[model samples]
Target: MTGAMVTGAPETTGYGGTLAAEAARFAALGWMRGTSGNLSVVTGRDPVRLLVTASGLDKGELRPGDMVLVDEEGTAVPGATAAGKPSAEAALHARVVRLTGAGAVVHVHTVASVAMGRRRPGGIAFRDLEMLKGLGRSAHDEEVVLPVIRNSQDMSVLGDRLEAALDPGVPAVVVAGHGLYAWGADLREARRHTEVVEWLLELQLAEERGR
Candidate 1:
């Protein structure tokens, strides 16, 4: 929301610790490359403040300093110096937190997720998979629909559409041709959701190919 500034990596007590550790893990798995995905943690709730990674930093080498402070409106906060602007998709993260009471959000681009999202008019459907339980199902036969919405360059439109498309009871959604947005009550759950959703997407693709 304002001119970005610079800061050092964050300490172990906060979001910096999670980002520094998790971002690289996702990168090693080939999920984040070319600085393509964004992650955030809700640092404050009343005013909706967050520590979001600055745009264009390689996730493989994310550091605490690489994170920026921003408000619910996605405006850069006065402190928590930043090396770059928050990711362009920061608005989507804010929306998820506001709408879902999510404490952390993870967005990533992966091939299977992108391909599946592209063809699903409303959303992608998953069923008869053991992984459904990772999304909070009681039975393997349960169905989970990962909602899909058209991707756009306009944050306002994307934010609005994504909000309307979201199911807070679920873990993730798809921004068509872009990728997956996953969240949880905390950073650990959010990370697990992202991993499980990604695995489900890849498995769905593999099964279809086998068929």
Candidate 2:
């Protein structure tokens, strides 16, 4: 395909718009400060194409233009006028989507997530919280474990580690000393999982302090 070739992306739809809005909101909360996080939403499934944030762009300033459409292999669609490069961790997003049948994925570097992951390298479990309902967990004392894997730069290695550690039932994974990865059937559900997991970690921190 020629460099001038343009691929079809969601122009009329607001998928990118929603991601940008959430990126800005998370930036305000320091979840994605300094462009430390990445977000993606699947645009097409037949050829497995998704819109991922560009590498090194400030999440606070995240906009649709900062997103690039890429296929499952992390290659930019042949006919898209995409100027931004897909995130370096796009492979991870691809894995999450494929493994979980997710339509969207979110990765964020939040203090509480990093802290909790570091504290429990294996994983952390939450229970007795009403917010657990957000994850489809019973609001009673049922336990929900969010998997944690050691942080690694090699996408292949990290992918393997995540595959082994991830709990299929959970919507997110914590990267020790790194951050969290959340996904769902769509952007709205993915964002909800991200928010709920982050909230649980923050609450855990507060509760630990009281001890």
Candidate 3:
């Protein structure tokens, strides 16, 4: 345990490659510019282990070895590897999974999400958009509210607020002036939820500007 380590040897699995690809994809879309975002996938459920993107690496350039295994509390597990530290927000990601039973989580910075979160710190509500279906919601007349929680330097404080505001029906939440966090049953679903929520926020921002 003197050196870095992970359980079940995730390095031998495809988790790293999957995370790297997703990070690169989001980076290309400008949501994960530089090293500002992180993505993770659940590797175990009984004790809740995950493979999260290591901290401080350029999301656009993450490699197959750029992942760290962490426990339910987001503490890196001691085993055997050189994978760097877990993302600063790894705890929040873990909390999301515990709360929602999501298999993957995507946290990213986006202009629309930041702007909307800042403007509506209480929460942002959406309805009557076909895109709602993408979030697994009714697209006709029902409402979907994406919770917004104030950002905190302490992950514990942030996590507590997130828990208080989380809507079981919603797969996404915005950290005011920070970014958005989206999760789903898996990486692909999480990515789709992120994109759909971001699109909805963009549309709302545009409508507000026009008003």
Please give the lDDT score at residue 93 for candidate 1. 89
lDDT of 1 by residue, 67-139 (tens): 8777897777775564578976887788888888888888888898898887675888888877778878754
* Candidate 3 deviation (Cα RMSD): 3.7
lDDT measured at residue 117 in model 3 versus the true structure, 0 to 100:
98
TM-score, per-candidate, Cα-based: 0.91, 0.92, 0.94
Residue pairs with colliding backbones in model 2 are 6-79, 7-79, 7-80
- Judged by lDDT relative to the true structure, which candidate is superior, 2 or 3? 3
Least well predicted 10-residue stretch by lDDT in candidate 1: 1-10
Task: Candidate 3: count the clashes.
Answer: 2
> Model 1 scores what on Cα lDDT?
0.80
Instruction: Write one digit per residue (lDDT tens) for candidate 2, span 113-182.
Output: 9999989888898888999999998978688999999989988789889889878789999999999999
Q: How accurate is candidate 2 locally (lDDT)?
A: 0.82
User: Which portions of model 1 miss their true places by more than 4 Å?
Assistant: 1-9
